[model samples]
Target: MPLTARHPARGLLDATQDDLGCGWAWDQVHNVTPRADLSCTYCQHRMHAKRSVAGLRYFAHDPGGPQCSLGLETMEHRLLKLQLATAIRGAGHQADLEVRGPEGRWRADVLATTGSGRRMAWEAQMSSITADDARRRTATLAADCVVVCWVFVEGHRPWMPYVPAIRVRPPADRADPWRVITGLFRWTGLHWEPVQVLLDDFVAWTLNEQVVPRRFSPPRDYWVGGWTAPQYLAQAARRRL
Candidate 1:
């Protein structure tokens, strides 16, 4: 299920918004009767508005439709995309969900674009992926000038230290927000250490170009990031950029 759908006359419609950008009340599409004219943004199939027990709003594919690529994504993956997109917009950047590369070379879970034209793909890789496969996919996006960072919500990932990725603690309840558990690091002159930050703050800083990835030396294969602000970098005097 997704939070966005297409309305023939109103353009793109967002279930998460109280105001559909066109001054239409969110209820115009949500209610006991709900609108029947909505369609999927990806497959152009008919869609229906739905609200989860948790009160989250989204659009679900109508029954018996061709399997849409977006419809195939897991619930966790879709929620994470919602989180990433909201954060990117909160940071004053643009976030496009389920973005496809030219000729379908690659599909990004969430494609974030900065005001300066730089783009980054945030991939929520909750499912298992071989280290080599992850590297290959990351390389594919990079070849298209789109950098990627894999994200894992569970803690048992063996590829954690081998890819450009981060571990986030997913919300346990509606009141909890995602907390960045790792993936962002700071060089302490002698070694690197993880930095604790709220997901929203980290996403914002990253989109603003204040945080950056630091690739490890020849012996290591993974990449992590640190803030570029003077205070954060002052401790890494001995580490070369």
Candidate 2:
């Protein structure tokens, strides 16, 4: 049998003081002493702080301790979900963080309901997930009229050949909405900025099989302006020069 290794660090529900008793609270994680007041949020084991070279802090269990799935989340995953929830609510939609769907069949990192009755499930995928797993999750959510969108948090290295690109499948309610949407989350010092593009003119650019966008930058703030598929190809080609 192949040996398996446990994940080093994972995301906390909220690093804020509200979760102070959780032991790995943002404030307590920076302290020099190990906290005995709280237990692991997932497993009831005691956790100790592990600081990185960059001074970023996370929690870890003692040797021979059992592993935790919830503790396998990265800090990026936590922050992105929080920010997305806040942004969704700010956009005048009803946003709920870490909400469970009907019968607890599914859980969305950030579930937002638009004023016009559109329910969107935003998933910030920072870890590796199989194609089958992705399809299964999507199918389950779709059954409940929930549109699930996977957002990659790879930060702005779109120039890399292996970066992920997604095809836009219009909502079932729409009529032949042939738009291609592609993008990723970029870390801008303090927060992650979502760079997404939905282009109807992708057919012309798709002809050049080598073209792929590394980042999506709108002309102005928000998803405004006319971003054509050709423009993205042009920008990508120039960077290769």
Candidate 3:
């Protein structure tokens, strides 16, 4: 998907670069890398290396540096939001990707406007989450638009509120299922590897029989285990710098 031309411009010190669309320029002073050549007019932080992922470019920064304030995880989350925006637009929707709300305050990860002028918002939760924050943002969605949460499970298919979640598994009839079985065992620290099952079957099992206990709990306890959207947002809210 390609980026929409609806990007809202703001007060930004644009840097001179050949690939303007493939690289990012921030106030150089906010960058933290020792070799950064740019200086930021707004803060003491210095710019780091230029990183490109999935064809989009971004300026990397280290907030843990002496003068830096934002955490590295926070920066990564922002990048993830950008990547998700790109993905959403590639799906053929007139997506604004990321944009400031009418108040010029809140920025949505992905704001898509359909041909019929319907608007929708999507927040990709690859990190931690807070229930309160989620509830608040969820409420702010446009009256005619739907707010959808797409939780990517890293190596697994994404989990959505309306869609059933299922784990990927190898075919049972394979002659050497052990190799694939062992991979799943190592991938997800589970007592037993997942067997191929229909999405409906998995949903039924998750809601009905407690064949497998809830793999994910809530808050802090869940973060230590593995990456989950709810856990990521919860942690993101508590950062100081």
What's the true lDDT of residue 198 in model 1?
85
Residue-level lDDT of model 3, residues 217-240, one tens digit each, is 344222121212333333443442
Q: How many backbone clashes does candidate 1 have?
A: 0
TM-score between candidate 2 and the true structure: 0.43
Ranking by lDDT: 1, 2, 3
lDDT against the true structure, each candidate: 0.76, 0.48, 0.36
Per-model TM-score, in order, reads 0.82, 0.43, 0.39
Give the range where candidate 1 is weakest over 10 consecutive residues by summed lDDT: 223-232
TM-score rank order: 1, 2, 3
Q: For candidate 2, lDDT tens digit of each residue in 82-135?
A: 555545654556665556688778878667787678787766666666655666
Whose lDDT is higher: candidate 2's or candidate 3's?
2
Whole-model alpha-carbon lDDT for candidate 2: 0.48
In candidate 2, stretches whose alpha carbon ends up further than 4 angstroms from where it belongs are: 1-66, 155-181, 184-241
**TM-score comparison, 2 vs 3, better candidate:** 2
